[model samples]
Target: MPTVLVTGASRGLGREFVRQYAAAGWQVIACARNPDTMGDLASDSTVLQKLDLLDPATITALANALVDRPIDILLNNAGTMGSQSFAKHGLNVQRFGQSDYADWEHLFQVNVLGPMRMAEAFVEHVAASKRKVIVTLTSMVGSMATNAAGGLYAYRSSKAAANAIMKSMSIDLAARGIIATPIHPGWAKTEMGGPNAPLNPVDAVAGVRRVIDGLTPEKAGRFWQFDGTEMPW
Candidate 1:
């Protein structure tokens, strides 16, 4: 069985990815901050890795744990949107015009730095895999040129930063035969996307699967929507 490793697998899209990949006969490595909270995942013989994006030690430990194993796909899906403080939560906080940098720092750590660090730490392991793919979950809001509706502050900018970070990884890891792609799962109806969001997790996940299945190394580092549209940076 091909092995797939997903972060933040206790809920939302991460949970769906775990279920789908496992059902498809992949050896799933499901990582979450609380493995105890992953009762459903634990029952499936999926490798439950406890990881907190806020903790560097935990990240390092996860890398060390998987060093010997080949991981077909590494989904850098764990992230945060912060509290709905409007300006305080987003652009303003990012520019140092805010009261609480707490959420801002947390968001950057999780949304921006976390994926880069994870990909860096696991590049060798993923290189050893059969499929040799590294996919990061980004957002349309991350597109500075396309973000028409404003106000998600930290979430928006951090995701954009993540896109840039992953771009560098794609460039550097290309010669190693790894294909790294940033995908916008679209307005997925997850907790972050809220209940009124347009796309269901299953449909969105399918779209992502389709993109991954059809993508080539030549397409690496591009921004793609769930439906396979090329998103502008």
Candidate 2:
């Protein structure tokens, strides 16, 4: 069976990805910052371990733990938004006024650096699988062309950075035959997405999975929307 690993598998899109992938008969390794609260997910025997992407030691340990195992798909799904840091006051309403650079740094830490680190640690394991694919969850907001109504400075920039890194990784890891792509999961209903989100999380996952299913090595390093359309960086 194909084995897939999803980071931030505790809740929201990450949790949904784990459920869907595991339900499809794939060996799902659901990872989260807190595995203690993830007892429900642990019911799946295939779930490998919980991981904290922000912690380098934990990352290395997780990689070491999976040393001989094959990981087919690696889903870099964990992320944080600046709103979670500065509270509700600082929005586009103020237009960058009172914006916290610290929040930006934290956002980049999770959204950009976290994915890059995870991929580096797990690339070898992914290569050993039948299907070697690394799917980094990016956002359409990362598209420079699509950022006409700019507001989410930190979140948008971090995701954009992730797209760039994932592209570079595709090129760098090509010799190992791994296919990597930065996929834009359209805004969906979730805690991160909020109630105003247009698409339901389940539908969004379905669309993204379809795009993932059809990807080829030629499609590697590309920025694609949930509908499988090429997105301009």
Candidate 3:
């Protein structure tokens, strides 16, 4: 069976990814800030691990523990939209003149730096696998061409940086047969997406899985939506 290492598997899309992949018989290394919070994700094929994207030590430790394993997919799915609750405050907290440098720094740590660190630590595991792939869950708000409203400054910039990192990884790791790309999961009704959002976690994750399933060398380094449409970077 193919092995997939997924970060942020405690809840939301990450949890859904764990469910889907485990159901399909993949060996899942599910990483969360608190492994105990991954409720019911445990199975014979699923290994729950503790991970905190903000801490480099935890990342390195996990990589070392799984050193001998060839991970077919390295799913960098952990991210943040700062401390603001989009469900209650909407985009007001992240709007112009309301920029919080601390929050922005936290967002960059999780959204941008975390994936870069993961890629660096796990590159060998991915390259050794039969179906080598690295996927980062970015957002449409990150797209320069798609930005019209322009309110989520921190979140948007972090994701954009993540896209750039994945692009570089795609180019640098091509010779190793690793396909690196960033994918947008759409406005799903998660805590970050708010209750008003149209897409549900289940369907959104399913779409993302299909996109990952279809990834190829020619398709690496591009921005893709959950529905399989390429987004402008």
Candidate 1 backbone overlaps, count:
2
Tens-place lDDT per residue, model 1, 16-86, is: 98888888888999999998877767645488999888888888898897788999898998878776533
Provide the global lDDT of candidate 2 against the true structure.
Answer: 0.84
C-alpha lDDT score of every prediction, in listed order: 0.83, 0.84, 0.93
Provide the global lDDT of candidate 1 against the true structure: 0.83
Report the error of model 1 at residue 232, Å. Answer: 0.5
- Please state every model's RMSD to the true fold in angstroms: 2.9, 2.1, 0.9
Q: What TM-score fits each model?
A: 0.91, 0.93, 0.98
Query: Number of backbone collisions per candidate, in order?
Result: 2, 0, 0
Q: What residue runs in model 3 are displaced by over 4 Å at the alpha carbon?
A: none
Best of the two (1, 3) by TM-score: 3
By summed lDDT, the worst window of 10 consecutive residues in model 2 runs over 85-94
**Which candidate achieves the best TM-score against the true structure?**
3
Descending-lDDT candidate ranking: 3, 2, 1
Error of 2 at 15 (Å): 0.4
